[model samples]
Target chain A: MARTVIYERVALIGLGLIAGSMGLRMKRDGLAGEVVGTARSAKTRDMAVGLGLCDRVTDTAAEAVQDADLVVLCVPVGAMEDVAREIGPHLKPGATVSDVGSVKRAVAEAIGPHLPDGVDFIPAHPLAGTEHSGPESGFPELFDNRWCLLTPVTDSPDAVERLTRFWRAMGSNVETMDADHHDLVLAVTSHAPHLIAYTMVGVADDLRRVTDSEVIKYSAAGFRDFTRIAASDPVMWRDVFLNNKDATLEILGRFTEELFSLQRAIRKGDGEMLHEYFTRTRAIRRGVIEAGQDTDKPDFGRGTKP
Target chain B: MARTVIYERVALIGLGLIAGSMGLRMKRDGLAGEVVGTARSAKTRDMAVGLGLCDRVTDTAAEAVQDADLVVLCVPVGAMEDVAREIGPHLKPGATVSDVGSVKRAVAEAIGPHLPDGVDFIPAHPLAGTEHSGPESGFPELFDNRWCLLTPVTDSPDAVERLTRFWRAMGSNVETMDADHHDLVLAVTSHAPHLIAYTMVGVADDLRRVTDSEVIKYSAAGFRDFTRIAASDPVMWRDVFLNNKDATLEILGRFTEELFSLQRAIRKGDGEMLHEYFTRTRAIRRGVIEAGQDTDKPDFGRGTKP
Candidate 1:
């Protein structure tokens, strides 16, 4: 199965789920001639080499991106700047540098100034992940049919197109948006929802009357989904909230207002209002299914889609 | 394929997911000699008969419960009293009466006094359902490996045991608790989570800056699960919030307090506190999986579980 290679060499600055998955998929698709990777954790670096996710496991970010044509920063949002500073002078001339961070504006603000002028800087985010993280949690099919948004702060059409092709070859649908809009969209779609899930799980944990055992045993009653969302990598989510503070807080404020309205309706026995609100939300779920973003089958088509 | 029958006649007073599943399972298992069902909506009654989910379909609640050895009121919580009043005099002496409302204490209060002295009243809730509703939305395996909780206020051990056997035959594990405890437990597990989900989805819907198309298209980023839970039957959830007001409000208050603390942590750039809070909740998700309440497979095990 021969295919056109998108890049001569690819360097991943972090060997976590997204980067590991990128390595596996690129290798499977023969998208790059050589793949080099590194991580701050020796365990992760060792696991990447052992799993054969990359052709070369480098000792430092500077060494990894030395001659790579496509370098991706896959570290937590908070660590992006330091990594960019370390690797800036070592980046190959005319090479494209991108990232898979959740918050775009913050990533641009943190890493943009550290990149060298000759290197093309384009930030991206793949709106795809499981709760699991680290090098061991990746799979080749993690990005199949998933959206990958490119929020390029630099005006480099050729570089952006090249990065888009790489993601498309790895089974992702690519869309480009500005940094600020991407962050706001994500705050609504991912950040606020994750915070709400985390808070709900925390409240359930803190309730003394509802024993931990009871909550765990009866989680199938809709609480289990919240638990699953809240179980995501803590460091990634922490950086997301810290970086996208304004959008997250704004969305949360709106959430609180909506919640209070529903609470008042419940207290006043306003069944009509409650019913209307609940019924309207159902239409959005249908739209998601129709848009090919999610499956409409019962239980998320679990137990059958594979 | 002969098996010992649990009851001669079982009557389901509503034809929604729970009752529809119960009727289908009973017929498939041959646990009841005849299953009778009726719904307030003519369309639902017609669909129940068309699907052959029950052996007989009645036009009225009184007719449905005429000689039923077991009468299960599967109506919304607010309608329990009216259904009980209409069916009370017609229930056969020695019949075991029950309901499948999420709010057990309110259900017991609404339907208890209307029951005849000779009839045993036990309120039960089968903690199993898909987002779909109506008679056609049910299947025989809906209750498989799920829990059916019975909260009986009566002192009839024999009747309780009989009802337990009935649910077990339908592939549900049974547990008995006092009504108030059941209400509180459900408030924590089901009601509050649902209200929060509905609120989050509503907030997304109301955000003018984020187009509905964008929200629907990018829902896989954790918002889709909330929409799935919020897509549940509106009438049923409205009744749940109204009937279980005290416990639901108490849990909501706790959820708001926890959310505000996390919001402050985000605003103050306190990643340490955020990470600690997020990491602790992952353990509960593990507990849920270990308890066999949910699967740990990525994406809710949507593709491989079947």
Candidate 2:
């Protein structure tokens, strides 16, 4: 099938995993006529160009966004405001400005005021990533069968629909949601779970009785999964918690309450309570598998042998 | 290579994932001359026989263990004593009796007194499993390259050596550790993590504002991993916590302490603290991947296109 070119020119303002993946997928499928990428670090820019992640690399975000019909801020949430300020004057008129930040509300608040009058600011977050970052860590298939959510800050159906079509061309299912609700939902799904994983791994690291080698060797039992989650980019997650503070903290408070109850049940030997709680959670796993959001294969179909 | 037969007859007392995997692997490699299995549920016994998990299915534990050179109690930790009592007299005089329980100390205490004078009791735990459980869920490759820790309670080096050979023949690296220490190590590696996962999933389920369907859909973010851990067999996990009370509670206490500190960092907007903690956890993940306990590929190399 012949692919439709959604944008004549697309600019990615940070050459990290998310932006690199978007550039690769767009180039692979001919979804964009020309992809221009920029990064604060010169090494990342050179790597992105060398890897063919974009058609060209620029030294500044302002240069990358010039004359681009679509501009995406792919930097960390904490850096969104500065990038927005730097490229605000260079953006093309009537261009759609979006982002791939984990926290939508904060990103919008930071970038909303800096944009020019005719540009549409549509905040988007593609629910796709690996435990890796940087320009070299992306693949064209990263967004395949994943979700990309858009929270449009302006009343521009044309731009929203166009961006939606672009994400679908890259093999992502697109949905639009309220920015506050997006942050809250993400808090429940991503932010709080990451913090908990980091905490568990840290606790294991600090324990005096169990050596680090033992923890690593015997991790197949359960802890290995947490280690994977905790291995995600440290700066990205730190900014995520700091930007989406209220929602993440709210979800963490609720998590602590629930954990305390389960801990009490363990102390009291309330086998019934534990059994019921565990049984109830299985339904959610089934839901996730049925939704095609995750693999149901045993051990995520990981290789059994080393 | 021609396979070596470690035991003339091996009896499995429960037709669950571990025992079924053992039977299938033994049958595939000819590790045992005859494999017999018995389960409390007649349906499970029939399925084990139909799936060829064992050479034969018996109606009772005593019948399964009759003249068996090795008898393995694969039931829950809470039911170890009862199963041991039922099969004690039927076990061969020179037979080795072992278990594949998660909590070793409690299992050793439960089954130690029930065994006859001549029978050797050695508690073992194979740190290998998927979220799924049951006769049909077992696969021959489940224990390949996985750690199987042995906490032997008997003085018979011959019996210990023979059992170790049996596990090795089935593709496991075997190690011996003190039962109490094994329990504590497992608490750090598996028990506490499992509980934390369960608590987080439960909290997500109970949040009314975030609908269950939404949680399931957006689960790819990070919560999906926890759901897989939370989906494990409820009865088995219940018994694990109830049996390994002290170690699990101690680990949970430490986990809570670390969680609270991270929570405070988030509340105080202490990005440095969060970054350092997260960065520290990444080293453990590298250790796990380097030790060959987990895959370093992105997302366990799960299929991207569903």
Candidate 3:
């Protein structure tokens, strides 16, 4: 099928998993007439170009954003401000500035001040990823069927609509919401769960009685899922927790309280309470499946191999 | 591809996921001359027979085990004692009786006293399952490449050897360990992680600020994994926690301590500490993958669909 070009020139800064995937999808679907990508490390840029993730590679964010109609900052949440400052003067007038950060409020705060007056600053977050990272780890289908949340920071209806179309062309369902609400919703859905998973894996590692090998060998019972969540990019996650501190901490506080109550139930042998709580959680799983956010097949349809 | 018959007649005391899977595997491979299954619920018994999980279905455990060479209890850990007393009088002399309960030590204690002196009672647990349960959920390949831990409370080497071969024929790697050690190991790898998942999902559900629809729609961002773990059979998990209280409580205490430390780091904006903790946990994920306990493919190799 022939594709329509959404943007004449699109510049992607910090080519990692998210950016590389965007580059692949945009170039494959002709969503952008020209795609230029850059990263701090020379090796990553080389790899992105070798993998056909971009039409060209640049050594600097400033060099990449020149004359581009759309510039997306795809770096860690902590690095957003630095990239924004570097590329602010280089951005073309009336260009739409956006990002794929996990935390929308923080990204908006970081990039909103650096944009030129005519630039349309729209912050976005794609709620899709794998545990893998790096330019080589990306694929064109990463955004297919997933959500791309847009929190428009500027009064640019035309720019927001165009970006929505661009994301839809890249195979994402687009939705717009307030940046602060987005952060809080994400804290409940993503941030707290990741911290909890990391903590559980860390606890398993620190336990002297259970040897690491034993924990590894018998993980399928449940611990392996926590490990998979914990294996996500460390720098990315650290920046997330730091940048979105208030919301994540709030969710963690609620989680701790709930955990303690369940622990008390276990201590008291309150089977009814435990059973009720577990039964309640199953409905959420069904909702997720019904929402088409996950597969209903057992074990995520993982292949059974000995 | 001929399979040697390990038992002349095998009795399964409950027709749930584990029992049904065992029956399907044994019948398909000709590992047993006949597979007889019994369940308290008539609907479950009918479903098991309709699914061909057993050659025959019995209404009572006593009738199912009569003259059987092998009898395996596949009930909740809390119900082990009553089932043991029910079938104790009918168990054939020299029969090897085992169980598929998650908590080994408690199950051994629940079952050992009721068995006849001539009967060899061995408690076993397969570290394999999916979120779904019941008779209809069973499949022949459910135990393929899974670990089955046996905590033998008997002195008969011949019985233990035969049971070991029986599990191997059903496509599981069998290991024998002390019941206490098995309980502690499982507390770290399964019990504690499950409780943590349950708590996170409960927190998400209770946060009225984030509506249920939003939580379900955006769950792909780490929260969905917790929901899957939390969706497991509630009665089974409640029994596991109640029966394995001490070890699970111990693990939960450690988890709480580690979580607080990380939470403090987040509150203090200690990026270095958070980065170090997250990076350390990545090694465990690699270990789990190398140990073959889980798939290394991204997102457990889930299919991308809208």
Candidate 4:
């Protein structure tokens, strides 16, 4: 199937995994005539060009967005405002400005007022990524079958529709959600879970009794999954925790409360309660598999072959 | 490699994933002759026979162990003592008795006294499994390149050596550790981590705002991995927690303490602290990959292709 060119020029600010993959995917699908990208670091910009992640690697955000019909802010949550400000005046009058930030409400609030009147501020989060970052870490198929959530605070319906088409053309499932609701859902899904994984890994690290070699050697039993998630980009995750504080805290509170109940069950040797709790959680895993969100193969489809 | 047959008339006293896999692999490797199995549920025993998981499916533990050279207790941790007691009188002289239980110290304590004299009690835990269980879920390759830790509390060196060779022939790397230390190492590596995964999945389930469908759909971000670990067999996990209470709780206490600090950091908007913590945890993930315990491929090597 062929995709229409939704944008004459697409500019990606911050050539990391998300933006880099977006560029490659957009180019591969013929969704953009030209993909211009800029990174804060010169090394990243050079690498982006070397990897052919963009049609053109510009020196600055302003240069990249000069004639771009679609400008994506792919920087961390903390840098969204600065990138928006830098590219605001250079954005085409009828351009649709979106972001790939994980936290929607904070990204919208930070970059909302910075955009000019004629442009649209559609805060979006592509619910897809790998632990690896930078331009070389991305591939054209990264977003295929993954959801890209759009939280458009702008009143322009046409802009949202066009941007939704752009994402779909790039091999993503587009869904519109409210900014606050998106944050809460993401807090439930991504932010809080990452924090818990990080916490568990940290606890294992701090345990003096279990040597690091043992933790790493025997990780395949269960702890290895936590390590895979905890290996995500540190700066981006830190910003996510800082920006999505309230919702993350709320989810954590619920998590700790439930954990305490299970802990008490273990202490009192209440096998039935633990059994019931574990049984119920298994249903959600089945749901994920049925929804096609994950593979049903054992161990997340990891091979057992040597 | 053609593995040497280490035992004749081996009895597996539960037709679950571990025992079923062991039976299949032993047959594949030519490591056992006449692999017999028995399950408390007639349905499971029938299924094991139907799947050709064993040479014979006996009705009772006593019947299965008669004239057996090796008997493995593959039931849940809570049932170890009773199963041992039931099979004690029927065991052949100088038979090697071992278990595939997750927690070592507790299994030793429960089944040690029940074993008849002249039998060796060598508790072993194979750090390999999938989310699926039961007689039909066994695969001959499931233990390939995985760790199998043995905690031999008995004084029979020859018996321990024979059991180690048996596990190695089943396609696992064998290592020996003290039972108590084994519990503590696994507490950090497996038990606490599973509890946390279960807690997070339960919290996602309990949330009224985030519907179950949305969670299942967007689980790939992080929660999907938790769901995978949390989807383990309920009865087995329940017994693990109840039997390994002290060590799991100790790890959980340290876990909550670290979680509290991270929560405080998030509350204070301490991005630096979060970044530092996440960065340190990445080293452990790298170690896991380097040790061949897990793959370094993005998203646990899950494909991005649609």
The most accurate candidate by DockQ is: 1
- Cα distance off (Å), candidate 3, residue A174: 0.9
Docking quality of model 1: it rates as: medium
- For B1-306, candidate 4 gives per-residue lDDT tens digits of 766779988999999988988888888778888899999899999898887879888889999999999999999999999998898888888998999999998899999888888888889999888888887888887787888999997798899899988888887899999998899889999999999999999999988355546877777667888888999999999999998999999999999999999999999988889999999998888888988887776435321211
lDDT of 2 by residue, A23-112 (tens): 888988899999999998999999999989899999999999989999999999999999999999998899999999999998999999
**Residue B105, candidate 1: alpha-carbon lDDT:** 87
Candidate 4 clashing pairs?
Answer: none
The CAPRI classification for model 4 reads as: medium
- When sorted by DockQ, best at the front, the candidate numbers are 1, 3, 2, 4
TM-score for chain A as predicted in candidate 2 = 0.96
Clashing pairs for predicted structure model 1, backbone only: A302-B302, A303-B305, A303-B306, A306-B303
Note the residue pairs that clash in candidate 2: none
Tens digit of per-residue lDDT, candidate 1, span A62-148? 999989999999999999999999999898889999999999998998999998888888999998888778888888888888889
Looking at candidate 2, what is the lDDT of residue A10?
97
Docking class of 3: medium
Instruction: Write down the TM-score of every candidate.
Output: 0.97, 0.97, 0.97, 0.97
lDDT at position B153, candidate 3: 88
Against the reference, the lDDT scores of all candidates come to 0.87, 0.89, 0.88, 0.86
**Higher-lDDT candidate of 1 and 3:** 3
Tens digits of lDDT, candidate 3, B73-113: 99999999999999999999999999999999889888988
